[model samples]
Target: MWQGLLAFVALAAMAGCGEQNGPEAQMAQGQAPNVKIAQPLAQDVTEWDEYTGRIEAVSSVDVRARVSGYLEKVNFKAGEKVKKGDLLFLIDPKPFKAQLNYAEAELERARAKHELAKNDLERAKRLFRAKAISEEEHDARSKGLREAVAAVQSAEANVYTARLNLDYTKVRAPIDGRIGRELITEGNLVNGGGADATRLTFIVSTDPVYVYVDADERSVLKYRRLGQHIGAGQTPVRLAVADEDDFPHQGTLDYISPREDTATGTVTLRGVFPNTDDLLSPGFFARMRVRGSTPYPAILLPDRAIATDQAQRFVWVVNQDNQVEYRPVTLGAHIGQSRVIKEGVKPEEWVVIEGLQKLRPGIKVNPERLSLAAPY
Candidate 1:
């Protein structure tokens, strides 16, 4: 029984040895040298950042009626671009005029009473000196005169307030901007106390418009470290309308927010685009591009050349013998369709942009001469 067991173990060992020494196994080991590889390449890439920006007017205001009254007429067209002091809407001034007249009449009455009180006080002063009237009567008359003066002042203030209400009947454009649709039509009562009575509409400044965008703090910090001030005159912004194939107009940076947005944790940047022809409007989404200082002699690669290995980024670089080697690279911000290489590469090196799926380190490459084609 022992001899049969030993014979079975010997037969298994011999079969394993034969399989290891087979011709098929030897051929598979030598095939690693034939695999293709890529070399590092150079490219002129401009780094760009894409942020979802909202088009906003530099100045936006809501027009509201001050006095509670019926909207008599709308003077301007809805959605019309209006200038400052342009007539927007007119509320019925009949009520305001009546109140003004009442106030003015009261003021006149108070003035007449004040004149009478003054004359009476003067008479009391003269009579007191002659001892014809008691000092108490003189004091009372003097007090009455003072009270009459105060009443006159109060009436004057009321008249001024009434005039202000009358002026409120005419809703005028406070700023030069494009007016929105009127919220309340003629004969509709606008909220006197608040903007409820009539929504005169919104007016937003379209000329030298604002583009509000956000950038990650890290990217902003990186930009700051480069010692570039993204300010007006220094920073030129180019904008592309949603449907336009190309960016037609350029703008300047207007204002940068004092603090970063806490909710999104990004800095809010606003750029003012000149709208000479009034082509750009508020609430229209447009693609904004900002130029940064191009650090000349930057190393770059096509977008697909680099890949993440586990958690680290690495690229395949080919040597003179066409042998593939793995290289870890430090990546900077994306520039256009390519990437900016901060480290681990040099100029004039070929990089693998395509055919990277079937590639590994230490494999030989049969490099097919590729035509240097300009990117579309």
Candidate 2:
């Protein structure tokens, strides 16, 4: 009787197992995988080129002393905006005054000599008429008068030189700009060799700033071949700065190099920026974009959707069976916060953007269609 009961229990267990996976499971076997697979969607993707750049002053002037003298007073504060011909520094005038006095005295002495020579010439002519003096003596007097007149002219030139030297004591700004730090203090003598002398201060024009960006030979050729010539003929260059969220200033392409740099394999293109508020300074790094090129329609994927494999970049594609498959992709230039997808998955296909780590091929899954919770 016990053996019969055991056989019956075994039969019931087998029947229960059969019913668990009934006809419903067999019907869903092919369609279950395709029921809901999450994959990244790729739409239209555009192309763009980017370049890095830095801000600089177009006219950077270093204020130097023209004449050697003690720096008596600093008329303007450091970092102050100054106009053209503004007084920047003052030198001690005592020594220049003495030199001018000497020149004046010499001039006065020459004038006295000239007057004496004039009287002597007149007397010599009178004596020659009366035959009271020899011809040689009259000629000697005439020669003396000529020498005296030449001396007067020499003295006049010396006076003018002395006046110019005195004027040099007062130093003025060569260009209208914002001045930098003071190199020499009051009572310190600065040499005035001009080019060879150390700069007393720096003066850079802040109204308009210049920016230079590197464009490689390939890029230049590419643009030229496309007939874009985006760097030529007053083409507008857009600027992107690190400090600003949006493009704050608009610049135009002012210069494009003819040749490429052998060391860097790039050519320098220059742009002029209007820094009216003095916000842009030299050495600030920024990005440059060439305008006038037609933007292509492109598929943009958010930064989160892409993943990297060893030596290959791919995205997880959920198949009809709810299995994740790795799809290799090629990415193009950046578009705002997203990247332009050049190759890989198609649009509207569910890409495993989330829950990718827990997936394998042919794994049955309970697919929950994820919705975009926040707008990017």
Candidate 3:
């Protein structure tokens, strides 16, 4: 019985030894492991710097009255498009009209007085030449005529002012834009003129909207070095609204601040985009990006192939000998699922894209070559 048990144990040991020599066990004993490898894709690419920005109207105005009076009529609908010089509101024109009439009547009275003074002066001049009247009396008459002439000139000025005020009673649009709702409704007295004038509504131009963003000084300098001129419309930009996942709006850089904000160390930049469809509105939050660098040749690799070790980024490279090598790299902007390799990797070198867990430095690999035309 003991000899039979010993034979069984011996057979079990022999079976275990035979299993160790199979395919799986051979891999652990220095047989090459299979991995996917591909050379980096080389192409001309541009880098874009992203920023949070705000959409604004190219032209904005706070509508107000130039003459003070009770609002008589609101001529425009709330949030409607208006043309320049379009009648927007009507003040109490009755009072202004009456004032204008009185001024005209006064002007006529002054003209009559002026005519009488002219006749008097002519007679006084004749009397002085003939010595029929004393010189002092003639001089007094001449001075009286001069005073009348001054009064007439003053009355003419009053008439001009009255006509100007009458025209102001009919409020008109100052520019072409969309108007807001009336804040001072009909029958409400609105103060006009001076600093305390009441605000009736607001208007903002609809087409060709503006977007403002603040960029760091370093970035601004870089853009200047790249030959992006302010207001030249050469530099291109892109924008996306809050709900959008990708930038769909295209615009051009139209303005850059002449001075920087010392406190924040950032300069303001403005981009202009056409809003003929009225999709963009002032005060909307948006994400914008500016072309940071011109197109240049660069090497790119799949983002998944790169691994982070503490603070450093690295990747596994498969050389011509089919041996894995660890390499550190400098990275640039991310394009889709691929990363731009700024340094450390060459265009012709093959990088491991899969089976990274089975890789170690100096270990042989059975690499399956793949094309990097499309990212994986």
Candidate 4:
């Protein structure tokens, strides 16, 4: 009887030791892991799409000499602001002036001859009426008068042409903008007023600048369906330069190419921006963003709450029982710190924003409820 009682006590002691070493012992002693969670935020949001592009001038002009002559003077310094009709270059005007003088002398001579012929024709008419001159002689005087008048008209046209040529010697700015370096310097002979005219310099309008970008076919279709017409100048856009962290420049969509580029599968778009302070320039590499979609209510969660599982994206959703489960989600856009959840998550449901790494699907968590406004 004593041996049997001792054996039973020993067996109970070993069993107790085995129970302490088992997984149940850890379960009784260990605490649930702490995690922070918040409900998804639902708000009205507009999606923005980004693009890379280049800056272009709204108006650009290649200054070319309009008349051939030796360049005598450059009126404005290179890289300076100039207004319309401002003199930019002066060709040698001596030849044009000489031609003008000759034309004026010829005009005077023709006028004198015309007056003499008119007087002669009048006298002949009177003589013919008085039967003092023959019909043939009177006809000859009339013809001479007409010839003199034709000569006078031709001389007048020559004078006008000469004056126009003289004016062309003084090259003026065609637009108000900044000018580039002089390509043709003083004393250089420049060919002008022809297909192969010499380019003196170039200018670009600086006030209202243009930014050119290309968008894919899908984006174009999306914009069209959303009624966000980029060509109508209603869509708003923002841009930043390479060194800029934020988009400081604002503009409106002004133009869209009529046809898409077949090879590139993109449509060219232009945005107009007011560069009042001359902060923007042409040929600058820029990052542009335009409103991709209209404002609509969306479910949003902090980006930190999102987790990736191989090919899938998910979030740790806390159920009513304080348990976490992997919830697959479809994302839309990331605005600020919140990402748009297109599907798979409801606004009323809480998601684990903190302690995501310690979470597993269907695991119980000690969730300390936190607001989305809390910093990580």
Compared with the true structure, what per-residue lDDT tens digits does model 2 show for residues 1-376? 9999999999999997786675445434643332333334344433446678898887888878777778899899988899989988888878888989999999999999999999999999999999999999999999999999999999999999889878878888877778898988888978875577646888988878888988878766755544454334556667778977656588777777888889999888887888888888888998877653445665556556677778787776666665666688888677666666778867677665555555455555556676432212
Estimated TM-score per prediction?
0.71, 0.66, 0.84, 0.84
Which residue pairs show collisions in model 3? none
lDDT of 1 by residue, 1-376 (tens): 9999999999999998887665445434654323323344455555555555768787899887788878899888878889999888888999889999999999999999999999999999999999999999999999999999999999999999999999988888999988888888888878775535445688998888888888778866654543354443456667887887556678765555668889989887666788878888888887887655553556666677788889888777777776667888899866655577788766555555666765677666655544333222
Task: Name the candidate, 2 or 4, with the larger TM-score value.
Answer: 4
lDDT of 1 at 371: 36
lDDT of 4 at 115: 97
| Model 2 lowest lDDT segment of ten | 30-39
What lDDT tens digits, residue by residue, belong to model 3 across residues 1-376?
9999999999999998998887556666867899999999999888888889899998899988888999999999999899999999999988888998999898899889888888988998898899988988888888888888898888889889999998988889888889999888899998889999889999999889999999999988887766544335578899999999888999887788989999999999998898888889999999988888887888999988998889999999998899899999999888768999999899889999998887778888999999887432
- Residue-level lDDT for 356 in candidate 1: 71
Count steric clashes of candidate 1.
15
- Cα error, candidate 4, residue 80 (Å): 1.8
After superposition, the stretches of candidate 4 with alpha carbons farther than 4 Å from their true spots are 1-36, 134-136, 225-231, 366-376
RMSD of each: 7.2, 7.0, 4.3, 5.6
Q: What value does the lDDT take at residue 32 in candidate 3? A: 85
Alpha carbon RMSD to native, model 2: 7.0
Candidate 4 structure quality by residue, lDDT tens digits, 1-376: 9999999999999999888875445334665578999988877888888899999998899999888999999999998999999999999999999999999999999999999999999999999999999999999999999999999999999999999999999999999999999998899999988899999999999989888999998987776655444345688888898899778899877777879999999998788888999888899898888778877888888898999999899999899888788899999897767789999998899999999988767667789897775211
